[model samples]
Target: MPELERDNEVELAYGVRLRSSGVSATVGDVRQAPTATRPVRGVVADELLGDSGDAVARLLPVVEAAGMRTVLAVPLDDVQVPPTPFGGVRALTGEENYVELSVPGPDPDEGQVVLEVDEVGLVRWHIDVEAAATAVAIADNGTALAARGVAPVRAGIEQTFRIPIVQLDQGGVGGQQRGFLGFGVRKVLHLIRFPIEAAAAAVGKAVVGWWEDRRRPHALSLVTPESLGDVPPPDGVSAARLAELADKPFLVLVHGTFSTIRSGFAGLNRSGGGQPDLAELVARYEGRVLGFDHQTLHVDPTTNADWFLRRLPTDRPVTLDLLTHSRGGLVGRRIADPALAAAAGVPTPDVRRLIHVGTPNGGTVLASPKRWTTLIDVFTNLFSMLPEEVATPTAEAVIELVKQVATGVFNGLAGLTAMDPGNPAVTAANAQVFGGGASGAAGAVRAITSDFTPAAEDLRLRALNAIVDPFFGTGNDLVVPTQGVFEAGDYRVTDPFVVQSPSAVVHTAFFSDVRVRAKLGEWLPGAV
Candidate 1:
């Protein structure tokens, strides 16, 4: 390698080329230098640049003054896994640590010539490919410490650099010489998610739940409110509130996930004006619209259902019509269960109708580790379950392994865990209400589900669908698949309205669909 000699100090420089797939390009200018370099040695704590900044910032003054240009960027836009038959292949890149530092040597006018680089940034990648690297990671000499968060997963990549072998007295360009020198290596950061620790915990819990399901599955039948533990006492509707129902029925509007009274049922207040939200509009259909806001993240659906039932007005001025969105659908079905309603002190027949919009009755692809594993298990089991041998492996058995492997990848967050359709607790409750083909209490309560989504029409949605469509299916309202709102036997009992429109009705926008309110009014018989 050709080196630069100025004031007796030698600075090494080299040229590099990047190749991936079938395309190739030189590295882009470092938009931002990474903070840490791999193969860390004797360096003090304060010098590390991990928390908020890049390590390149510290080296820019020295490297720039040395007259060298540096650049970095992901070739081909993104390093993504190729799609496969089991839906979209979901292989994640571990860490890309190999950083190619390209430096142009000093001009002939500078008069001094000589050189060899002692270090190159780290080369990090999946364990499978880590061994096949050509770079070395090393620390800078005394005092000049590397920044933070920039340690490549795999280090010590070896490579050769091409430098021009020049004549000391020459003014014009001359022949080239190739030399292999190791440059300081920095780690690559994927700043899109939570810390590694939190992610691991989520996966651990998800796996435990997945395994637990086989040991004890959900009842999938009517359960009493008393059975739903830790459910907060139901909020009671005042006499004035019940009196308002005299004009119509009790239109209970329940919100799912992260929403509150004002933001959810009450409808958010926009700048100048806004249309009535689900609660307000649905109220017009039969009677007074009441909001059911529960702590979604920590509490599961059953617990929330317990709280939901208790909050109701003891004696209604009118009949009851239950309407729910997203996760709210889970609670709605539980409420419609004859056993649960009776336990809550209301006659099962008193709660007459169930209307669900964008409910994840089947399961949610997002945060439902069991669902993702189910994606793999479904296809694997399809072929695995062909044989009917008594001692042979079964699909149910395979689900445990698949779920463990899959859910273990992402710890089950409390909210996601509670609503996970695959979880025994959630599945048991659902099966009791939705699985066996009827919408609670046989023909006692009439039920209907309306699903609306624009699909992958927009560019952003298209990109997102590319990643999730494999699990959630192609038709989704961004969060849950519109079809997931309905179970396998749902059509046998509940009337389904799957809107096919070129116009997109996004997740939050489902409440704004004029058709939903109108349909509720038509389907809902006037007061009892």
Candidate 2:
């Protein structure tokens, strides 16, 4: 263990070094329990790990058995790493490179530590041949504060990494303000190593699990009044249920990205302040409502539509009405594409009515490759601030995506890319759905969009808007451009519902608004 003296560089265990002029700090082996625990104050371990804490509990024994060591840093005061230049022509010539870490002063309002770098400097580490290095900040409770992958400068033996400057405080979480760093809260930093193949495999497994659990890929479930807000059953509706609804017009619920039926539409089950409950629509439709849970990350909307069509009962003709949110609108449009329907050999002549709430029909700039990191940053903050409104599983998925992106392994995620304004899929889908006429078989499409600008009092939200608004260059509901939902290419929704500014109706909170509910009642009054 060593203390960082002002203006002097201190070498610590594991080839690590620290030099700072204005802060008191200590660096020690993380395996020393007390030293590791000191910095991670105020973190609720259960919140970071699962309630059981089984993951770490299981790892400690193995670490002790192998006699491994990890380094920990505790900053007694605000710290700054003087500007250092390391990567340039030397790096191009296969030489060592350096990176600086910029640690910001603690902000009482934000309870996390954020790692940033003004210039590219690599933190080099010697690791096992099979391992990949990563820099991670962890809260006492085990929540990941920030993580960045290390790039190998020399394969197997040497690695270099720069902590990305990611701002994770944009909104209030559970009514309280919090940042990704947990700054004021105690925190610890670790340069961890894991088998590259194993890490990749685990991420792949987690992605599959997230898609299986939340997306339910091509599954359809009966949404009854009693089950309006419940998670769709794993097995979906049985054949008997399909037979019972044969030849009847049904309303299909198509949820947005990283969402399940319950996560997307559950708000409809509750009402207040004289606001009408969406459940009334379920009863009104004579219980002929269905929820389509499908993949929204790895596959494009057309693929999702293809799967949905394949699962429909071919013995009977089906007519559909659609209620979609966010990217779901694209899938709904694809489902309604007459050509796709013909290809699937299903005689779905037209969607009787389609109601798009926060749907990115035209596409969103956030989905573009350059904006992927920003997209994840926005969602991370939003999830923290509006936990109840955002889907929980999606947060985990975003974290995984971050790791993948940091490692330079992220492909433009196909499902999200489909929403990119410049993506070919967006152009193709819009041309086919709106090309022939204003009303393709999607029939009478109406939209619910919002121009959401946070109020002056909502500092964090305003901050988030500041970061996101530039990309849109227009009004948006945080994730989707306001105009994009109703107009694209050759189409313009004649009288789309607009949730004007000065309102708190974000993309996720659209269905929770009284005005939106009332509009739903007006548009889809059910079986009448």
Give candidates' CA RMSD values in order: 19.0, 10.8
Model 2 residue runs over 4 Å out of place are 1-215, 225-229, 387-390, 433-436
Q: What lDDT does candidate 2 reach at residue 370? A: 51
lDDT of 1 by residue, 1-528 (tens): 222121122222123233222111222222222322211121122222222122233322322322222222221122122233543223211122122223222121111111111112211111112211211111111111122121222222322222211111111213422211111111222111001122323453343343333332222111112221111134335545554554555666666654333333321222112344333343355435555655444446766776555545556423567767777777777776666666877545345567777777776655353233323322222222122221012222332323222112233234555555545565555545342345764233333343333243232233233334554545766566666666533333345776554654555545445555455556555454
Q: lDDT of each prediction vs. the true structure?
A: 0.37, 0.56
Candidate 2 C-alpha error for residue 285, in Å: 0.8
Predicted structure 1, TM vs. truth: 0.48
Residue 469, model 1, lDDT:
50
Tens-digit lDDT track for model 2 on 98-196? 222222211221112121111111111122111222111111122221221222122222333332222224246457664322111222343322122
TM-scores of all candidate predictions against the true structure: 0.48, 0.68
